[model samples]
Target: MSHPQGKELSIAVVGGGISALAAAHRLVELAPRCRLKVFEATGRLGGVISTVHRDGYQIEQSADNFITTVPHAVKLCQQLGLEHQLVETNPQYRRTFVVRQGRLHKLPDGFLMMAPTRLWPLAVTPILSPLGKLRAALEYFVPPRRDDADESMAAFVRRRLGGEVFQRLVEPLVSAVYAADMEKLSVLATLPRFREMECRYGSLIRAMRAQRRLHPQTTHESGARYSMFVTLRDGLTSLVDALAARLPPGSVCLNTEVVGLQRA
Candidate 1:
């Protein structure tokens, strides 16, 4: 990365995480003379996505698996030729349980977030009161609110569903993922498509149903290949090793740490 005004053709990448590694790799591919280097603050690279094997247990520090439905991760796997090692989640365990009333309860099938494609099951769900369910059901009649401006996850869920659903269901579900306060998580930033869906269809359920109808083959197609969750067979580290192997000799540095950054 030659500073437009400087002589050295050098590039400085902060953090030896995947983004920095991928950035350097891309730079090497596009401009071999760019002299790209990655700087990591910690003793290790790979950031939070490190794997530990102890006592015959392989544990992921963060990001247990990537969703196959997302193309970027799948494409990377194909590029690395790690397709053979790809592991898919068991289809039978598709249902994810949510913590409710100090207990884990299975979320009803066909319930995509607060949107319920199947009504009877939602109507009978113990997660919410009948009154709350009625309030959620009335969404079909209530016109979309003009105040569609960005709202927090809690606000969005409560408005569409009810206070009970937001408190018991969405709160715990969000906690499972981001582990952040519902009031702080922006619905538009986190799930913008959902904001759009409500804007288009008065009801969230109606929007999901319409989407399912439009892309029926995706959900209804029998024996759909690939699972929602995926990882490497040996472990996530295998994926990291695969990438490291692809780099040219003397390219990647191990045990390197960086402290300060400043422009000269």
Candidate 2:
């Protein structure tokens, strides 16, 4: 690959996820003189990230909230002249995760990034066996280990605590994030902060607790303005439609598939 300084270049982006849309948008901003082609496999861009609207109902496939802590999505909205259209999640559902069985379980308050440090609930929660609970509770007393470089979400929870926590708590939580299986999941890729959290606080719980101390309000976010789950009011297709409208005439070749690429 060559970097051309002080020269315009044509760019092609594939798979119109939010990333591709953002890339195309940036190419327009930074290199309007350069040609931009977004080749999406389907008829529409945004891939699994599109939204739908039907008679007062909105639906989404994937690529949901960009973290409030992360400025990229929010800033992009602002730049798109969409700040007013930015709706925070519904306050009622802001502190939500998911539940399967017959109980309403709140992921421990102040727990950030999928690690639980603060105790009371972890000890009493039925999600773990008494032994598992004891084992997890032991994190407070056990000194941090620096030798281990990485561990799977399954192995880590099972070793430090028990299988129940792995299957019930970590599995569902991790799966929801990755849409993947926990056993083969890469901890380093998904949860690198574990190493940092352990190293910094000597315990995951302590790190979570400390983080909570810094952002106490994020803990009790009930009835707060906006929520963690959110989407556009006009449905996501509005975004793709707008993007398609901006393309130059004859820029798109429809109903055609290119199977390979090579240099002449």
Candidate 3:
């Protein structure tokens, strides 16, 4: 687009992944006449977000769905005129299960990630032992960590909810989503809201209970807020294709990896 100095602004995006493609598309929308280029190390786009079709079924390589609570993906789809293709998760199967001793047990209702909004379900879930359940319940009275320092997810869960809850419940659930080591995964970088809740309400259980009271519909929900998740009907590739289509012709340069940069 034209700059304040009456010159066209040129932009270069490094990567052909969904994030980079979305950025280029947004830039094009905001500045229709701007010069842009996208460089991809691989010959293909979409990164790990690929969909394969075979035998009348769609297979997702990585993430099959995106959570709508973030709003960015939904807004992007709407902007690309692909809102009609969005599909919500089945209502009847919104719950998540965790395996313990080679058996599947339903995650407690109203237990969203690390905290439980409803205590009754947490009290009754077989996922935790009597001692574990009692420990989790004590979270209501646990003092908040007053400092702003960062801590690992494992540490955070153990400190607030106890080791049993971390091992049997939180670890599996969080690992399924992030696939990262709990000992190294930064709680501040991932789910800072939990820390904020602890600071504001002084206890995770108390904070979650207050939130449930504020948003009563979530009282019966469970696990990772599956009700907020959705996927594209055709597949996530449609989103990549739509983004690539909206860019100017010859804007994408595949198999072009930048090794170093220097001042011109």
Best-fitting candidate, scored by TM-score: 3
Ranking by TM-score: 3, 1, 2
lDDT of 2 by residue, 1-264 (tens): 223665557676665656777777777777667666676666766667767667876777665554565577667766666667666666445554437487767655433445664577666665567876777767766676677567776776566555765666667667776788777777777677776787788877788788768866566442112344445556555555556555655554444455665432
The residue pairs found clashing in candidate 2 are: 89-227, 117-205
Off by over 4 Å in 2: 1-10, 97-105, 108-113, 220-231, 235-237
Question: Tens digits of per-residue lDDT for model 1 on 17-113?
Answer: 7767766666766666666566666766677778999999988887667777668777777878988888887666555577667887766555665
Q: What is the model-wide C-alpha lDDT for candidate 3?
A: 0.90
Q: lDDT for each of the candidates?
A: 0.70, 0.63, 0.90
Candidate 3, run of 10 with poorest lDDT: 255-264
Residue 80 in model 1: shift from native, Å?
2.2
User: Per-candidate TM vs. native?
Assistant: 0.81, 0.78, 0.87
Each model's total of backbone clashes: 1, 2, 1
Name the weakest run of 10 consecutive residues (lDDT summed) in model 1. 217-226
